[model samples]
Target: MSKRNFNKMDDDQIRGSSRVLRSSLAKKGGHLDEKFKKRKMTDLDPRSSQVRNQRGRLNQTKVKGTKSLAEKHVSTDAKKGKQGTKTTVWSIKDKHEYKIQLPLSVDTSISWITGCHLMDSGEIIMTDFYNKSLKKLDRTSATVTVCDLPSIPFGMCYIGNNTVAVSLGQKLQFANISGDMNLMQSVDTDHYCKGLTYHDSKILTVNDNSVFIHNYNGKQERCLFTYDSNAYFQGIAVSDDGQRIYIASWNIGLVTIDNKGNHLFTLSDPELNDPFRLSLDNHGNVLICYPHSNIVMQVSPDGKNEMGRIIKATDSIEWPNSLYFDRNTSSIIVGCGGSAYLYVFDLK
Candidate 1:
């Protein structure tokens, strides 16, 4: 095995890689469709989130594929009331997190992991944009296996039966994670894709302003309402029942939309700057992060209440991104972009 260390490159090799990365981004920028071209890349600034703050409370949730004992939970409460009004009582606390070393097998480039998903089998999968590969971390043996991709990748989600769909810039590539990592199917999108999620048998992807919904067979189904460029949505999360959609907008805060594509509300916070990713715990609450700000927070199901801080800069989170609230394990899995550590937080 090649020597697998975080600092695999000497000074000269690191500098060369840095130059190549900048040039590559510039080349890709020439094809932007005006909307994404004008938007500020909030996630690329590693120092944006610099303040050290106290931790936020992570909302309580049930284990995936199990029953929730909390009666009239957050998801149900929204449906019982008017269109968007929701009263929430959050039962949350500071989560206990421990960083684990993910040894790489195939590549040595600085790992800019953009997405992570914990499978039902307890293995974790992630998309590394810097290395242009997909990696699977086996929890039992602490062994990692890799599958190279055809292009730079973005977000991804777990499709059933040992399969996952990854977001390429203009396409959605589905691959089987069971073995061989065979390319299963590819769905062409209407726009360059960023954040992606699967809900109600439909796949959802985002650009600077619009959310494109696609059918399972790679067909453009329908698009939700397109907000202005200020929306700057890149990360998305859907309620378990697929009724509410939470989009992370870098310019604004979280924007809530209903199933029929109506804008329910846009929730902004002064403390919120450049929100980048969104995930949901099993029970129905939303989880989001500011990569540059180095913080992760939990929000109520209706997108009205900010639950508490789940993680913060004081907790040693640096340039945090590629966040996933793993429903299978009922834990929050975080991959810090450009770092070697993968953090798994056990919810209290």
Candidate 2:
């Protein structure tokens, strides 16, 4: 029957009937604490905040369900704690940066950009394991050259004047950009490597287990330092002035080592999650990328005499693989493979 037809009686009859219904409902189980009563006994009430709260609590107690992430905790304004660095300043949001579309139609799954270095001729030398080639990008002419290599190239760094040392398939390959297609030297090792940088006349490489430092000429390989098993090292960077060497671990945070690879400090903890790549800004601040979370993190220098802010590109990146900070223009470049674009952010 319709509600209007059932309540066709006078107001007095309706009041009396509601009073009797309340009395019957109270006697059955209403006397007990509302919180302790079974939900089945509760009546559906659209305006009841109490019911909503109770239902939320009930769902939280259940273990097997898709849980929603806490929005406020990850919000941009939630917290900006000073970790011996300047407050993080986001200069670019996701999908808001400029993208440089590549003309090469290679359909390889690019894992990471690995390393970026500007040659003496102002060419951007980017290494990638996707095509197993040393790719050269002429920023001025907008031309890209892919050089075939015997194996995968993981990392590249300028060793001396024009020599670049590349970590390729458990070996170090040295080549001079000005010379012919000849390998100056090849240092063989059993360690799985990723990032490469040079400091204090030594070549630093991040192994799966630890960070190793060798002579710039690739003559020797020795363990300068090691971290706990918690850290899966990926990227390595050395300051131009020769004071710091920053190593990016998979998720264990960054370990700042000195010239000898002796641990100077750790920039992150277990709570920071994953850091896939590392780059140094012109001001010596450490720029990091969290691939799983799709965010870029920056850690300022110890002195914190930094003027430029820590900028992040959020919108334009879908799985940001690498980070490169151009000191001349003060622009940061992020390579996102899904979008197949490079995101650039400016910080002042």
Candidate 3:
């Protein structure tokens, strides 16, 4: 053999030699790359790109399957009254037994009872929109005008133990209702105020198509969100956690949004023909009153399902406008637009 000339070896020759050495070691079940030296070399090697792709697909399928199972669990648990599921507390089967008639006098001149709230003491407060008056009915059914508003009083909600905030056109009046209704202060808004609710120490008001959020002192913090003008926004309610807001419209059903003013979804069920006012039970179930349909429906928080009609038209519910769920009594107080009677239903 001639004198070895290692220095004369070209790049291709060196590479070829290394490949041969690696091939020999590989045949002996040895790995050449330090990164994968100790790894297994099965047909389904974890380090292989094909295996990784397969794993990714499997993980995706597993995630989807888990979500589907969770959804099914919610549906099944609703009927079973289990946690993580909507309990069917309100139902039509118990409708007739729970109906309590309001004690309004037959001679009362109240035109349209638009908004209402229930106090812990079992008192029902309401706004006579057409009469431009705030009225209260004690637990004994004795009704009286609490105070007269300058503009039409559309919506009202309790802001304090003995105080309430009433929406009157473009102004929100803070009224004290301890002994008698007295205007404490007022807050002005850019748009008209139709419905009002308090959440996270803030006042949420709605008008034609816009929702406005304001501080307790009447300062407009922001316009929460606006809906299409074709649909008239009527009733408003805020979730207990202040994370979600539910709005009722005339033509459209209900619109739900996050606290950050993001539109989450719309609930326009055929059963929710004319959603007027909305309320939330302790469990965050949506209680909606439909005037045209003369019915009150309980819906899931996600707006994907309607629990059922809590009070149906056949139950003698007519022109249901304002709705409130009383935690103390576990009852729903419904005020009508034209009728002098307020219907109370105790959930079983």
TM-score of each: 0.73, 0.64, 0.69
| lDDT scores in order | 0.65, 0.53, 0.61
lDDT of 3 by residue, 1-348 (tens): 011111233445434443443353342322124433232111212233321112111011010111110111111112223134457747533332111222122112323577877665666677765445566666453434345565567788776556677887778776666555555667778887877887656778887678888876667889879876656787888766567888887667888898888889887876445577888776778889876677888889876577888887778755677888766556787786544455677776
Clashing residue pairs, candidate 1?
49-292, 49-293, 56-309, 57-308, 57-309
Question: 262 in model 1: Cα distance from truth in Å?
Answer: 0.4
lDDT of 2 by residue, 152-258 (tens): 67777765455667887578876554422234556786676667776656677877658777675665568877886757677877665567777777655777777
lDDT of 1 at 221: 79
TM for candidate 2 is: 0.64
What candidate 2 gets wrong by more than 4 Å, as runs, is 1-112, 178-184, 269-272, 303-313
Cα deviation in Å at residue 104, candidate 3? 12
Residue 238 of model 3 has an lDDT of 75
Q: Which ten residues in a row are the worst by lDDT in model 3?
A: 61-70
lDDT of 1 by residue, 114-185 (tens): 898876677778887756667777666656556666666778877555767788878887777774354555
Worst 10 residues of 2 by lDDT: 54-63
lDDT of 1 at 213: 88
